[model samples]
Target: MSYQALYRAWRPQKFDDLVGQELVTKTLKNALMTKQTSHAYLFTGPRGTGKTSAAKIFSKAINCHFQKDGEPCNECDTCTSITAGRQNDVIEIDAASNNGVEEIRDIRDKVKYAPTECDYKIYIIDEVHMLSTGAFNALLKTLEEPPENVVFILATTEPHKIPATIISRTQRFDFRRIQPDTILQRMQYIVSQKQLKCEPAALKLIAKAAEGGMRDALSILDQVISFGNDEVTLDNALMVTGSVQNDELLQYLEQVTQKDTAKALEILHQILNDGKDAARFIEDLISFCRDLLLYQQMPEKVENDELNVVNDDFRNFSQKIKPEEIYQMIDLLNEQQENMRFTSHASIYLEVLTVKLATRQTTISPKTPQAAGEKLDPKDTIKVENLTRQVKQLQQQVEQLLQNQSNGQSVTATNSSRPKTTSYNKTQVRKTTAPAKVDLQQVYGVLSDATRTSLNELREIWDDLLNMLTVAQRAVMHVSSPVAASPDGVIVTFQFDFLCQRAQTDQPLKDTLENGLDRLIGHVPRLIFMPQEQWPQIRQEYLNGQKAQKHLTAGEDGQRTEQETPGDPKQPAPKDPVVDTALKLFGNEVVDIKND
Candidate 1:
């Protein structure tokens, strides 16, 4: 006989021999015993979860002549022949290769024939979703109305791709992934049966690496056994799986918690140098943080033996770190993971993430009143006293100014000379009058030359621009709208005055918006923020000024036309003398014509 892999050699031949599918096995066994088995069945779940094994076991058990209480007697000729794949009545098809309509039609044509040597003719189609639409349509009729003594078993990992009509006609059984503990127990039994010595932790590690797949667990165990001589140890298992030891991961986490950036980065470099995958390392770190958070919240709920770290060390570390810090760390790591997916320089990202984790500040707990008498740091105390004296001096200056206002006199220091006093008053007067007037001429000029075509283009992609921002930035700008656009800048008006102020003061938000816009569009125009309440008034005033100048020019042109053609009797109406006189004295165009 040729050498066989562990998964193939240890394939389950009976329903009772299969592990971690009790619900499916028990239900099928009862159905067989009652002689109420359906003609067609659908088994769906994750890979290596005993779907195919259960299908084969059920096929043999239903046809065995010496079957008792839904259990197959493997000693019988029928059972043995079926188990050895020599039976003509039982067939296994890989749909991934034979998923054409002609193949399905061939099966449909063969279903009419009676079984050659068994009670029923069984067909097991794995990966049934790979069948084409036409093939599915061809099989639909046969599945809905199958010949007697004929059984169809369809298995797939993705049931959603299968047609609803096909699923409705068959009895469906959903298989679940095997638990780690269950996988471990099965491995221990296999080791004992094969007369192999293995450490319990070694089996547990293999089980964890298998990720709820029994076939994967067995394959890993088989490789580990081949690598070691007699006994399988935890270190050997870790080596075969290319996984880091728990101690190494724990030390790295310790450096991060202690805020030691240099050591944390060194550990990260070493892990990568040892050929560990950067993405996988991040995944394991996230799982470790989750475990710590769980253990911190409920110690009794955590299985200490299953944990990768020593229980004592885990407990001590949990005490040193708070729950909120762990949450923030997880969030930051997840964000970094998302960012790393789009970049080729994953090592650089991982290094940067390590430093960020190490440098993040831990939140301080509030101290109670009883602990207030503890000695404070001298530097902090000195800074606090200096700030207090400056605050007092400012308060005194404010009070003196208020007193001088009540007495109707300017505030002047008694010790200051007359020249210094005059200089102070003049400076204060200039500060008061600085912002009372604004020259709108420059703004009007910019608006007149603004390109509406560019503004329209921006309006079309405004939503896309907002979508590119982070969630926090989006929330801050949600109430704002782009009201006016210019070639050099865009004027965004906010519904609330405070929101406008916030948008103006937030430099980082402005930079992010600019960068995002530059990526979407070719250029990043300047953003001008104003409150919505003020926008209409400013726009209306500018438009009215423009209209008045047009009307004045029109009046002058009409007068000239009348003088040029004197034969026409029509003449222009006279303007108000007072308005004309005011316009002449001020040397400005008349903005309004009033009636007396």
Candidate 2:
């Protein structure tokens, strides 16, 4: 006999044999015994949870003459034939290969016929989610209304990919992933049956590696058995799965918890060099942290089957780490795992993650009166006090400035009310008088490169950008409009002079604007804020300059024509007052004078 894979040899033969999905198995068994089964059934779940096995078992039990309690006797001729797959009526289809419209049409064509050997004709379509859109449409009618004696069973790992129309027409059963303990017990039974020598820890390692798949667990176990020459060991299981051992995971976690970045990194380097996968290592760490959290939170209620880490060392180590710290570790490791997908250099991300985990301080649970059990570190408390003081200073400055403005005095912030930060020059006065005159040179420079497309793009995200700004900045920006936008800068015309001047000298506002624009548009632009009162004058100046330049150009062209043609010899060109004077001084040989 040819050697068969463990997954195939130890395939579940009955609904009772299915692992970790009592709800699905019990429902199917009830449906079978009552003979109230739907014509079409949809089995959706992760792989290797016995969807196909359950479908096969249903087919045999429905046809078995000696069936009892919805279970097939497996001794009768029809049951034996179906079990051996010799029953012509029970067909198993792999939808991954035969996922064309034509294939579905073929099934549709044959479904109307009566069964040749059994009471019912069965079609089990595996990986049914892989079927083409056209094929799903083709199967829609037959699946919803198959012949009285025909049954359709569709199984898929990804139900989301299956069409809703197809899903709506069938009785759906979602198979869940088999638990590690369930997988562990099954493996133990198989090993004892085969008289194989295997360590319990080795079986546990294989169970965790399976990630809730029975067939995966068996396959891994088979490889480990072969590697150890039919005697499975913990070392062989670890090597086969490319997973780091629990001790290494523990060592790494301890180092990180103790704030030893160098030691943690060194241990990680050794693990990766020993051929342990970086992704798998990260998963192990995440799992370890999760188990530690569970145990710490509910030591008495923690189930033996719920955790992968069940050791004296882990329990003692759990005492050294806080729940908040574990939460942070999980978050960091999960983020690094996401980062690993985009780059091939997993070690770099791991190293970065190590530094972050080791350097992060434990969250402090303060005993303050404001909020009991809330976390507030001393640094955060200091920050809050500083911010409160600054806010008070800003309020005083605003009140003083408003009072001065009402009395028609110069705008100024009292020295006592001024902010400690020198980066912001709130008290600096512009040489130009109060209505906040625009900088003509800057405005003209912006207009030179301004584009309608750039302005429109700027307008699209104006409201969102305002929301992203600080409260004080948003108040100023809300009354402003982005009038002109170039590749390198934006001109914001404000409705008020104080807001404009305030925005001009506010370094934090500038930083916030640049950061927000960079985040939203991928380009940081120089911001120029001006009052709306100055916009008309600046716009008029720009328009007049453009018109004058055009007129001068036209006048020069006319003079060139006069110099070239002698002016039709009948009519003399009119003289311009400005051009005539310039020509009198520079000579008529230079250009003929023309009036516009």
Q: Pick the candidate with the highest lDDT.
A: 2
Write model 1 residue lDDT over 229-281, tens digit each, in one string: 75689888877776766667788989998889899889988988887767777
TM-score of each: 0.60, 0.62
| Residue 472 in model 2: lDDT | 74
Local distance difference test scores for all models: 0.80, 0.82
For model 2, the superposed segments whose C-alpha errors exceed 4 Å read 301-312, 365-596
Clashing pairs in 1: none
Question: Which candidate achieves the best TM-score against the true structure?
Answer: 2
